[model samples]
Target: MLTLAETPPGAVVRVIEIMGGRGMRLRLMRMGLNLGDLVKVLSSGPLRGPVYLENLSTGVKLALGRGVASKVLVEPQ
Candidate 1:
């Protein structure tokens, strides 16, 4: 198991769960980041910034701030 936020760039992870409110949770869900979904870390931020991720299912990419990304639990493959 590994935190999605902690995963290095170019790595892939499977979403486990999201810990947050409905608003924030819904936002990520709408972005195709649902549980069991696979995502690839495109790039991490500078020092402590946001992280870029590419959705394996939808082929969409998104940049999530570190704080938010940290809340997203995942399993590294």
Candidate 2:
């Protein structure tokens, strides 16, 4: 298991857990990122920038801040 922020670009992973408050979790869910969802890391920005991810099932892409990405736990798929 690894945090979303640690995943390399182009890596596919399944969301396991989100270690954040209700609002943060809800926000991610609204963006199609929920527990058990498969997503691909499109890009991880440099210098502590946002991370870009794409949902494999919905083809929805989202740009999340590094803080948020660090709270999302995932497993390699």
Candidate 3:
């Protein structure tokens, strides 16, 4: 499984698994990112910076730190 951190820009991916605790999951869910949702990577900052993406399901855009993004498992759609 590829992580959101490892996905390149412009790739549309589906959320498969979130390898973290309830707090993290809830945080993401509140941001409109949930399991099976489709998202596209908009851009990634340099030097282990945040990852910018758009949740296709809700049309919400967000930027997540690399550490947080690494826990979000995804598959290309």
Which candidate has the highest TM-score of all? 3
What is the lDDT for 7 in model 2? 97
What does candidate 3's lDDT look like per residue over 1-77, in tens digits? 79999999999999999999999999999988999999999998998999999999999999999999999999999
How do these models rank on TM-score, best leading? 3, 2, 1
**lDDT (CA) for every model shown?**
0.88, 0.94, 0.97
Model 2 residue 11 CA deviation (Å) reads 0.3
Writing each residue's lDDT as its tens digit, candidate 1 over 3-42 gives 7779999999989888888998889988777888889999
Tens digits of lDDT, candidate 2, 1-77:
89999999999999999999999999999988999989999999998999999999788999999999999999998
Candidate 1 residues lying further than 4 Å off, grouped into runs, are: none
Cα lDDT for residue 12, candidate 3: 98
The per-residue C-alpha lDDT of model 3 at residue 27 equals 97
Off-target runs (Cα >4 Å) in candidate 2 are none
* Model 1 worst lDDT window (10 residues): 29-38
> If scored against the real structure, what TM-score would every candidate get?
0.91, 0.95, 0.97
Candidate 3 wrong stretches, greater than 4 Å? none
Candidate number with greatest lDDT: 3
